[model samples]
Target: MDASRQIAARIEFLRRQLVDREPGPLRDAYLAVPTRERPVLQGTTTPALTQIWQQRPSGLITPATAETQPIDLIDVYLTFEEIFGFAAGPAYPVKQLQALPLGFVLQFCAELLNALSRPGASHSDVDRAFATQWLKEPIRTRVLNELRDPRRALVVPQALMLLARAAVEHSPDSLPDGAKPGNLIGALLAFSDMIGPSGEGGPTVLGEQPGDLGREVIANQYFNNNASVPHTFARYVRRWRELPQQFAGKDGLVDLPAVYEQCTGVTLDDLTVVAGALWAAACNGNVLTPTAELETLLPAGQVAKVLALISADLETLRQAVQSERARRHTEWTFDAFQQRPVIRLGAFLLVMDQRHLIDRAFGWLPILDVRFPPDTHPRPTNHEKLAGQAIRTLRRFSELYVSEVLHSITGQGTTTRRVYDDPELKAAFQGEGQKIADAAVDYGDTWVVVEVTTSQLQRDAATAVPGNAQVKDIDKLLEEVRQIDATIQALRRDESRLTGVSSQIRRRYLPLLLLTEGFPVNPVSMTVIRERAHKRGLLQGQDVMPLEVIDVEELEWIEALQEQQGVSLLAVVQRKQASSLERTSMRSFLADTITTPLSHPQRFEGKVSKALGPLEAVLLKRKQREP
Candidate 1:
């Protein structure tokens, strides 16, 4: 097939694999179309994909105000239960239920759905239908009721956002002429409330507020700073200016101080007369202004117009103080303590600033969200000389601890606990310091003292913590430490002797045994025999075996002898003994016959004696006898 047809067939196979259905004619269509343009022809969903896509509505529709309609609230509640499998509290009172309108029921539905979606879905999904449905419900009343009923109000911000969006979506009339509107304040307020007093604002809903005049103002002034106290204050100040009617009295006159005090808890007189100066300084960017304001706001305060001014800027002031507090906490300067040539017992010198130390140890670090900060650098308050002495003592103590407990169990420097912070102790252990230092816990109490110096502890009884480490216990580490040391010493002493013996055994004896072929051998007996043979000049002095010294002619001769007899070298020695025995037997026979001839007893005796004497001599005088 051509390349294009092959490609078409491959595409059909992939479609079948993914969707579990054959492409068939569709494969031909796909091949006919241009590759890049094929993407446009694909449907939004296929049979395999539609099952997961359209199961739920596009957006999470939270609680909203329902339009006027006579409907069974119970039936709507049941519908939600059927759809989402969520449960609700005891049904609303039937009497109260009768007075409730369609709007109230829609609001209830939105809230119920939002609660159900929280665990699995995002808040955006929950906020989608808020514009049309949930927002129409009374935002404040619903929020207040949520606050009172903890169970129902458990999801404050999400519920509020839903209502806010619903109100914005339904109230086209609330927006200015020919201008698009959004639920900027409602979203912000909902976020702020959701955070509650603890400041957990939950997930951000939109990228940013849409472009609406009122929304832009709210976004920059209030929501921008998030956790910044000053930014929160600025936001409240702007909010006060925009919503004058909310703070106005029956006479239609705005009560500025009341609004400021309510939002920031600062009085007007205090703002103008006392904090007025600090406010001016802060506006000009003076660092000390916040501190100055704290002093003013706490003391005798002013009221009326002055209070109103302070109230207007309350959030700003709060933010400034918080910023100043944060700055002071982190502004630390290090002082190098001069080294004293000598240190006396009980000498007092500040080690570190209590404030910084406390903070470094346990202060709130917003980044980590937990305490237990690391003790970074240990700055010495004493002179270098004095500090050195203290470090020496600490190291000595740690080493002693390791030696006492770990040495007995595993041996002195061999253990893991013997290292220490002291220079002397570390030097003493040297390469083994890590091992010993690790065992410090086993030695004794391994507490670190930041306050006491080594010199002080030596001179004053009170300076030393009672029951310091001892030498005897340190000696116990010797048990474990000695194992490695002993092994090393033994090896050094015997290596030469063992190596020489092994070389002699392998070179001289091994080949001799191999050549003999059937020589009966025992390693222990062979070793003994070889040593004796060496002393007796049987083996050569050079330590090479004698047999090995033979040339190829001798080796071939020995090999041929064995081949002809079908016997090993051991049998050749036995055969030489048999030849000697036969010669002795012949001589003995001749002597005996000559002495006892047939009937001549007297003369035969004489002849026999002479013959026997000569024969015996000849028999005894054979060339050699078997060994």
Candidate 2:
């Protein structure tokens, strides 16, 4: 009989005896069943218990009904097979599949199958596969799923981190792939943003504990392994870089918590994961500042584990960064060259112009051109454009600057030395006449003058010259000179109007001065104070003293009348208050007009006296009016 049939047959024979029940018969019948069915026959599955209800010949269930029903042996074995295919070790024969409790057996078998599949696979490939799947069905879907267990949803990001960490530890490609997978990163960030503000339940990212398996895996590979960590570290460092001074806290960094709270939704979670990733990454030989405040909450032993992991990964990250840096420099150099290619056919004209201009202006020796064959030229396609394209191709490198190339050519700060030193560029212009003559050639008794102008000269030495100076005719050049002169004169006049720095000391704040009185300080003192404030960037750098002052006689009269009525008139009126007072007065006037308060003689007199300031007091005295 098949295994399921045999087990079932044994169960049936035991059920018959349970109904008949004789001690000697029961013992013998239990022994008759197979070893696998023995436990069922005895009804002693761990924490031993017996069936309370059973089927019987009568309508009601007795012990016999429960016993005769017979467990679905086929379904039980099929469920076990469906859950876990493997039985034991990697090399264990599949033919030796044995029976065991379903849940326990499945756990062991699934783990074994996974291990068997992992052998020669790379981390990057695994990361890519996971990322593809994640992008299509991200954790956000699960987080939003109404039917999902909240605890399971909460741990999804950690699970992703776990897989990423495994790849990072075992495979170099995995770290790079995981770091650059924008879709996966975006989903993770979105989920984190949603959770950050909720602040309910456990932390989403794993901490450094054995129980925190996800974090441990990330730590082991990112920090402890030989792969570089900056790929991970950049996840955080970019945020804090170039932080504004005023926004920074007492620690010289922005208050992360407050900033995070202001950012609603999934953003807060993104910040946490990014910060954690960066911390781990930087520990692996990256150059970002190790902010200690972030690490203070972690346990002591985990810190040591992290440090060890970083030590292991440092070299890999270092090499990767170095390779990237060198690649960047190369592309930058190529672009600078392309943007300003060396002079080929037209170099002589530029040389001539430089010599002529300098000799005429300052009587200096001519600057020599670096010699090369006429054909020795930069690529017909711009060298700089090619370099720029190449440099831009690099994913994370910062662009190259002119200063970097200048440093490579003549050490740091050489452009200043080359352009401004001693003879000055003006002195080189006079020798242009010599350059024009040398570049000319005679053909068989026919004389021809090759036109050598500053434009041609500029093209020749574009790479070397700081400014693009090509000699145009007197009119255009004269116009340029006039524009420059005008600009300089304007600047000088503006400078003369500005107050000296010493004025800052003279206009210093005077303590105990009556603030409401608008203290009668000197005009110069007020002007200087205003100017100083403008220079120091206070009041948005507005020169209060320079602004025109105007008087509002109507407002002054109204204010004076208020003061005469015994109201404090020191109020510095504001727009909001003025609007409110206007609204109230209009409402009061309308209400009084509508009610006809003047109909009562005493009330009318009283209202008139209050509004006209004691006018009614004079009018009411009949004797005083009898003149």
Candidate 3:
């Protein structure tokens, strides 16, 4: 459901209108009327009433009133856009989409694209209009299913504008001087593409398909701007470029279509879906651009300045984090790693996840004082053996921690037991190839299958396979949870006695995978994992619980552990929904304790400048000394 690639494509489209590094027009130049222009219409431009009257059914407009009719084509299209709710610019709210039929948007976009490609006869040179049509339900369902949400759905209008504008901006020569795309690039092109490629369907006016549009667009985008789209796209393109024999011919031109198919798995029925998926992931919201907050705002524009500010903002944040880390000293003991009351692994996971650096933090796990026994902390030697024991002690503590927390929450009726107690299941897991659940809990009419995991083994975040080549570590971990959930479901269906539930009891299975990031990634990124699994027809049901990566207040947990002798699981889960992170308390805790020089924009700018000033001065001095 991530819209990274689509976002990338949109950004590339916008880059034509925005992201200019040169000294040029602040406003979009395409909106301005060209000094020298030729008329697209064959004859003198007539009033709107005359145009619609000509197309009117036999008796709708009589000679008595035809010439005097006040209706306008602009009014008609505007009403259509409003009623149907396909605005030519920006995203519409999910609430606004309720009135639209399912397939209408896609059908509209197709028509608009077609109309733009092969323009029709209009009375004005600036005529950019569409033939009217209704959206169907089936196409809407199909597009929605492929897209997964309204965010990408709303991008359809923006997509049309991006494409139409990019076509004009980048391939100006290709657009016919007479049939120029009008000032209403946002609205008219949106309607044009909605209609169809050439408005050639049964209800359409059917013109010759603009075959050259495809070639011109693809070539212009791919070759221009040092490769249009995200820089990440270049890496995908490089995959085929590196292995020329597999995809390229002796003539040396790479088979782009094959490469795209090979890289992203674009098939027909799911072409929209696959492309949407890749785009969502590629142009993921996590990947920030300078004008990300107000991407549409212009005139009093600051978009071009954003790229530099982003670098400054990031550097500022990095320095601030490093400073906070220096001052962040906990009185809690790591020596207690051997003891059950140890540092909260849950708290550790939550903090690192806030900065999107869990995997990197996990990779640095060996640096922890707990890795060695308390006895070995001061003068550590032969650490491997001690570290092994530490890991076992910590793991046992984590298991016990979960058991205790659940015991408090569920009271007497329900029980959460580590599945390791089951001899048969434990033996099955030990059997060379089999898998088993980490824990199982009985909680008020539900059998919760638990799988605990960390990206501790994830060395390279860039690789598809985190721990093993055959499976992503997270997927492998979740598979075991799913299997256990399924097994419980089957057993309940067949009347088997699970620990807390009797043979007569009916309990639905809820599979919970407590996943912690080992590498830095967006907190919402776990959806990419679940979605990818669902796309492959695995993990596709309401029975599968959402991957729980809830963020808890690290400081509150620390306070409770330090003073109240416990960290509350109920409190942690209650603080946020699964995959939702609230960094307010965490940030407040840090700010109250630390200087936080880069927290606000003005201060952040001042700090960044100050940090850079010294470095720049030193570098200049070094250069002078060298000369």
Candidate 4:
């Protein structure tokens, strides 16, 4: 048989073996198999296998249904190694195997089996084949090359165009009617905070037992960067509040709890209390029964409602896992915790229905819940059109945020949306209307020209696919870079026309592109930008400074650094521009250059609190009114 058919047959055979067996016996059988005899199973753990087996429903794992159960790649590898008796080579890490999709894992195993069947295939030959597939060089390189293709058109649609499309697609009646998106978002953020470790009564401490110490260490590593979540929440809240309320209800008087009730059929307070209880239970143990303390905190009805919203049954989870695995066949990225079907789809709780094997209870995986608004809502009718609108909204907010930060640092002299009024400059951009820089900051002799973009790297760009999506995302970013270069060129062409800056001092210009989302600022992208700039004659002049691309995270860090130490953004930019290494990202550059420690958490939380103060107050008032 061919490789594909061989894999399918192998999986079928394995499924039959596992179908009639109980989870505990199956787990014991698997663990009893000596790893010395089957070296490929070296990294497989008892806990991981037990977790996988527990996902199988009681009395439901018939021969017909066994194939439908979610298959962990590690389990497959172990099964194949035990059966085939392939020569033991280097063992793949459990984490690495776990990250791969079902399809990829099946193919990998099939390839291994095929190699072992070959006449003269030695250990080195099998290792070479393994390395090739594991690294994914062949596919990844093809995708990257396709992204650099020059023939691809780089046309980006305007905000108005997208808005018009959305309007055409959905009538006013079809738009979101129940809750204001802003209020709903605010309530969700508060709910997220309530369940977090740093919620209500400070950080929760895992016990001092031997096993607990490891758990505590893992939790600390993950949660140490506490500022990220709050900052993200604050940014989203600000963006949603500032954006035009195209989807919100007309009255706009919906409170936080009302919004939660409208969407979830439960009050935000009840949801928060229940979510906290579940979070606590999850932290304490992998599986927990409904306890007296949890019941005391929330009534049965409320608990059931909250569980319905956030938890899924084994079958539902299996389907979701299958769907996700299929979706990720093209998109190679993986975060085991974040990308788990239940977690990714806004369901953090897992309910095990097999009372015969284990008590009918909830199973908690150590995964952080980081679901966004869209994850909770129904999939939009037109995702592409709505995404465009979202991108435009983010771009506007990013520009505003960057301008405000600049104003704070350089004083009110920082000019935003400055029009090119010079006769020649106006004529140059006549066909495209008046050209304008997003913002310009004046620092005596130094002038900073800013361009803010919210262009994010698309999944296709990250995946091993030579598709249109990859090309389009790359083209959109390059187009933004081109615009930045053009603005810098225009400003330098006529220094006399520069507005809101002192004309007396000889000025040096710094070109900056501020991205709302992180972009790969590696050698390839930088080289591409430089090549494009050279073609446009933007880099020919000695006085011109190379453009710097920094994300909002770096901008926040810089702002904090400025407040703590007397470090200026201009100084950082100058140092980076002068550096011989062209591949390093702004974050790396900051880490290498800065000696003083940054008080990022303090400054970030302060800023978020200030930004979210009014909304938070309103939420608190609503909670206080609750009986």
Candidate 1 per-residue C-alpha lDDT over 1-627 given as tens digits, one digit per residue, 9 for 90 to 100? 999999999987765554334355454343322232223224311332221111112122333322211111101111222212343222222222223332333234333332332223443333333322433445434433433322222233322333322332232223335544343333333332322111112223222111122122221221111121222222222222222334344333334434334333443334333323332232332312233333333343332223222122223322433443332311110111001100111221111111111111111111111111113323233334333333333333323322322223222222123212234323434454232212111112111101111111011111111121111221222233332223223223332332232222212111111110011111211333344344444324242222211111122233333333333322322232233221111122222222332222121224323312322333344323323
lDDT of 3 at 282: 24
- Sum up the clashes in candidate 3: 38
- What would the per-residue lDDT of candidate 3 be over residues 474-552, giving only the tens digit for each residue? 4564464465555454445442333433545545555545432222112223443455455556434564544343211
How well does candidate 1 match the true structure in TM-score terms? Answer: 0.15
- Please give the distance, in angstroms, between residue 516's alpha carbon in candidate 2 and its true position after superposition: 41
Which has the greatest TM-score?
Answer: 4
Model 4 CA deviation exceeding 4 Å by range:
1-227, 241-314, 324-331, 335-391, 412-434, 464-472, 495-506, 532-540, 580-582, 601-627
RMSD of candidates 1 onward, in order: 46.0, 39.9, 29.3, 25.8
In candidate 1, stretches whose alpha carbon ends up further than 4 angstroms from where it belongs are 1-154, 158-269, 272-298, 303-627
Candidate 4 lDDT tens digits, 350-440: 2111110110111111101111222444544554444444444445555665665665554322322233322434444444544555666
Error of 4 at 244 (Å): 7.7
Report how far residue 540 has shifted in candidate 3, in Å.
Answer: 4.7
lDDT digits (tens) for residues 1-627 of candidate 2: 899999999998865645334454444444333342233334322222344454333223545332222121101111111113323232121111111221222222222222222323333333334334433444424323421321111212222222222222222222332343222333222322222111112234322111222222212222111111221122122222222123344323333323322222112233232223333233332213233422343333433332222121323432433444433311111121111111111111001111111121111010011011012223323434433332222111111111111122222221111211112212322244211111111111111111111211122111111111111211222232232223223222331222121122212110001111011122222233334434434323121112111111112222332333322111222221233222122122222223332122111223222322222332344336476
TM-score of each: 0.15, 0.13, 0.28, 0.47
State model 3's lDDT.
Answer: 0.31
- Assess candidate 4 and give its lDDT: 0.42
Is candidate 2 or 3 superior in lDDT?
Answer: 3
The lDDT per prediction is 0.26, 0.24, 0.31, 0.42
